[model samples]
Target: MCFLAESKINRIVFLSTVTDSFPKRHKGPSLTSPQRPTMRLASGHVAVQLHGEELTKIQKDFKGFGKGLVRLTPGGWLLPAPYTKFADKIYNTEFRASDVVIMTYPKCGTTWTQEVVWTMRNNPNFNHPKAGIPVKARSPFVDSDMLAHLGKDVLNSELLELVKDIVPHPDPDEGLALQLTANIPDPRTIKTHLPFSLMTPNLLDTAKVIYVARNPKDVVLSFHHHSRLMKSMSYVGSLDQYVDYFINDQLIYGPYWEHLREAWPRRDHPNMHFVFYEDMKADPMAELRKLNQFLGTDLTEEQLEKIAHYTSFEEMKRRDDFYREKEMQRLDQEVSKKDGGFFRKGEAGSWKGHLTDTQEAKINAWTKDNSQKLGITFRYSL
Candidate 1:
């Protein structure tokens, strides 16, 4: 939805790769009840149903998600079925004063920003052995119950080994990522797609939170590709079908407008920092500098330059393994290999290549209708 001249921008770099899979396949029956139950949302979207190949595929691929979706009452936020069990556990997570968290809706530069923030804060030298570890290990995604439920056969040995020594939780439904996030060393860097409303009320008071938002037009396109790429999602729906799900808030962690609106009013909180995907792409150096200041890291210009170089889009792509979950790709070799794996275009406004004019107009109107009162203007074309 937006564009910037890559040649005109100062290059910056970082790394992250999160391909979550269970150690074994779930051969048992679906954890959810057999009957599919549906609920209507405040927006008139069906909370537990999308009624298409998309929902069918999700239900087929992720048996743990009983109905494939579950609606959070009061707010009508739809999440993967595991939320029915993991919600309280996630909400009760402990936060440290020194912790830094990267929060965003899916595919909104969460990994990109995680690498940047993690490198700047924990691996400024870029030589730490931990730097080589996948970001999934370095920065735990607290809301990963969705991925943990994928129950794929290919396990992330790196992650499994990392958490091997930790005592397993009493609840079998608790995600490994949640345990890792809770037990990681201090000054932890965490990631999540959950909105603030679903998080602990003291999150802003307990730790620094960075929220990254992107234009819905680009987010919809990126998420569509991601859904298709992820084996757990196996989305075979058309672009138009996906777009309807996005705008209607039928997708998991959706009500995109509401997600941003939840953070916009809290943008001024001392511990909250807001960033735009377009701004980060347009000038990563500028955004990185802002992050440095917000973090009070006091890193010199030289360090920022080195961090920028290490996290550049080209460098990240070159070192794709460090930023992508390669194990998950084993099942969908053709799509992952053909589409360049998790590190896709990473460009703003790439939606122009795919979205029809009608789709664009519809998304634009939806954005205008929802965001007008929020005062959070998004750049469709940077």
Candidate 2:
């Protein structure tokens, strides 16, 4: 069975924590009900404060991140409150020197990059039966436990069958994804949306890290669609509203510029390989060659060409049935059929079609304010 198809069995969980004292000003809908007590995330010494103004500004129909967002103090990185549950595991995991870690804020060409890296590292021939396994299974997402805290019952029938025989973890706090990732032998390809501050301190020195960044404009659009399909997010907000969340740094794994900035300064580190989504889209073969060099995969030119074609947007879409989780298919069948399903239009600068002039200007201003000092620029169009 493809790990992509099997691993998704437990991937659809999402639940919110109730807060004892919510300032009346910020109370919003809970994940499952309307007008429930405001949700908040608390773990150990840190308690996230609900900003009334931010919550009130949210459209009434919004159901995902609006319920609650937590900021890890000192670093000020934002994530869903439940992240606290698995924070220690994520920050303290033992990384190996042979591991290849792919880091990105969500939807920033992560799947594409994962497919490319996994292909080069594991199955350059495209003939290996293991190569047919989904990238998710081959390169596990470490933060997956955070998304699956709600429990096993929420998973659809297909997923239930896949995970039925797996023994329950002895440590309640240890995430399934983290466990799977830890046991994946040597040269594992690990994926995470967590910023550097949240990962294990020695990660940079211990493992090869590939950081992929996309223009904030396109990230906002792709993330909007992702939220709608993820079930946990259940986002129904308009593109304009989503833009407000993006610019204000309220979305899960947001503060987009900050995420990139964390890696930008370290781009030259021997173990760090920084890539731009636009550059990859423009010239995948060149990017693949560069990646091949960084990974020291030593793929033949023929192998690189084959890997490039296999991971192309059109090809991935051709095999979307294997790529999509059952939950995604059930959440919104129309969305799955309308575009390329989870494999949506893989183009840069498509934000032009969805963002209004005001939204675009606001995002541009937000980008400047956050990224001016980083000395990095993005290509919003091809």
Candidate 3:
């Protein structure tokens, strides 16, 4: 099913299948309100006016459903239970030849990498002193249900205006990624947390994918804090309980081992590149150089240094309001009601402070087992 929205001369299209299942109710805007603009597509899918600030409360309510509300699809992958219907549409989405996909397991420096890549792609000469746009808007999340739910006309009108000169492709109703790709010009930046198994069949052949991996221990700690912060999926359990879920591969987009293993073998593929979060954190400049080389951007030493300066953890945090104001607003509201922001202590080995000796041992053993089993090695401490 597809949703068509009129915004100026551009037509925003959202494609999603109809499903009887809906997320559990919470204290937020009603999806069935008659006053809001609504459309029923030929595929029996219904689109509603659930974009912009209106979704903030609904997102919080959805997060309250907790980790137990995951959806295990027939494709043998897990997704946020509430977003399964959206994921269903993304799973079948198409790919474009000029796409640059940012692939990662959740909380594995997805945002940081995105900033670096987008800057490199659009501002190679460093002529643009400021980003002048949010990172999320610049590189839209391909599998984002928010984008799918809100439609391009609403969520990306600002972004579309920013790059309209560069993106002249025709529109299609395939999915968010395709829609964005069609509008954006060549070498479009796209992000996703989908495991390789669930990705488009021709993605490796058609697009350049930067896959980032991090130590599961750190990923767990960051993810725990992130989960708690995002009201839609906050966890009320102890760190021990959360680690149990991590060790057992029950977290969203987990089986970390399986996800990593599936993609590890494809690392040598010409169009694919694998990066370790630790390496990027350890020497961001070196990683940036590597990225510039891989992405075929002719950035000079000065340009590279400038990119590093702007995208550093401190700078990104300082400029969060500029790059991620909407997300920050949601998280800030969450913090007021709860307590956490998307950009928590961006450090490696942060897990050491939170994990007990026994818990550390458990994570270590699990990591060792999985690393050996998958024929991959990870630097647990930086």
Candidate 4:
């Protein structure tokens, strides 16, 4: 769909290599039994499934992407069949300069941050219609669960629509359009669902990065709901299991405090910006103003108002792009709602009531360890 500059892409590739050892390989995908296969992608190319019947692998093509199979998620593979090599095929060949990378741990406010950055780059008007193109393709998350567990048929439809929606004209060679977008020379913002360690090699060194984080207590609740909607993660151990996972460092991008700690020092580094979800939720206009200022742009009151209101949780909930993502098809029709949403009720205190007293105490202790050392306290809790 959209593209990141070549230099940024190069950095992402380098970093991905640094972190590339393959996390714990999952048991084969769980395509049968009660759980079905959900297919995600290699930049909207590969099919990431849990165990399921071997459906005929379809040749889904994007302009510059290589032919990739729909395999499975990064950290999970319930299928008994071999998957690492298969996943490697897609990941190894696909990520290029054109993909705008949005890297963050799960539940760390990635979706919201991606939307903000995408709007900053692509939706200059701030008042443009949301119907013209699919937001995901324009700014996609490569590792999104939607791309991971949805069926191939559904994934194909979304991919087709995303392609048509973003470029309108399709090149017979899938990689052509992407290459063109990459070579076009303007900055393109692509979102990623990958953690910092899993990002492409060359992205950070050359391109700008904005990392969004939330307090771990809220992240746990947020991730819990997110896991419920994502079938692959639905059966992930137990609440207690997850809580321990959170503390002992078992969750995806675990050691939540550590990830932030590593990134905290760079909060004020010229190319990178660190944002807290609570801060934005509390004063969206102020956040937007600051973000715009970072990008070397200023907004008229009307423009600022447009951006702020449109991205507001209340407003984003009504938009199809924000709520009904075509890619997140594996989520249960009923339970997904219970987990809140892409734009869950945006408040800092949601954790106050939900997080157990023990959990709160642990988070307090965790924050104390580095909140001041890493400048996290100054990063904005909103």
The deviation in Å at residue 241 for candidate 4 is 2.7
Q: How do these models rank on lDDT, best leading? A: 1, 2, 3, 4
Off by over 4 Å in 2: 1-61, 65-67, 150-173, 323-325, 328-330
| Candidate 4 residue runs with Cα over 4 Å from true position | 1-101, 126-132, 145-156, 165-186, 236-238, 321-329, 337-339, 370-375, 378-382
Report the error of model 4 at residue 163, Å. Answer: 1.7
**lDDT string, candidate 2, 38-75, tens digits:** 22222222334344555545425345444355554433
Model 4: per-residue Cα lDDT over 195-263, one tens digit each: 443344445555677778777777777777666565444433455555654665434434465566556
> lDDT (CA) for every model shown?
0.71, 0.70, 0.65, 0.50
Q: Lowest-lDDT window of 10 residues in candidate 2?
A: 1-10
- lDDT by residue for model 3 (1-382), tens: 3223322212223434323333331222234433443333222324443444534432443345422233222222344433433443454556676678999999999999998998898877657543566676568677764333332233333444554454465233333444554455455788888877666667889889999999888999998877676544545667787887677655657667777876899999989989999999899999998988888888899999988998888888777745455444234365434544677778888877688999899988877876887888777677
Deviating ranges (above 4 Å) for candidate 1? 1-67, 152-158, 165-173, 322-326, 329-331
Q: Model 1's lDDT to the true fold?
A: 0.71
> How many backbone overlaps does candidate 1 show?
13
- Which window of 10 residues has the lowest lDDT sum in candidate 1? 1-10
In order of appearance, the predictions have TM-scores of: 0.81, 0.81, 0.73, 0.65
Better of 3 and 4 by lDDT: 3
Tell me model 2's lDDT, rounded to 2 decimals: 0.70
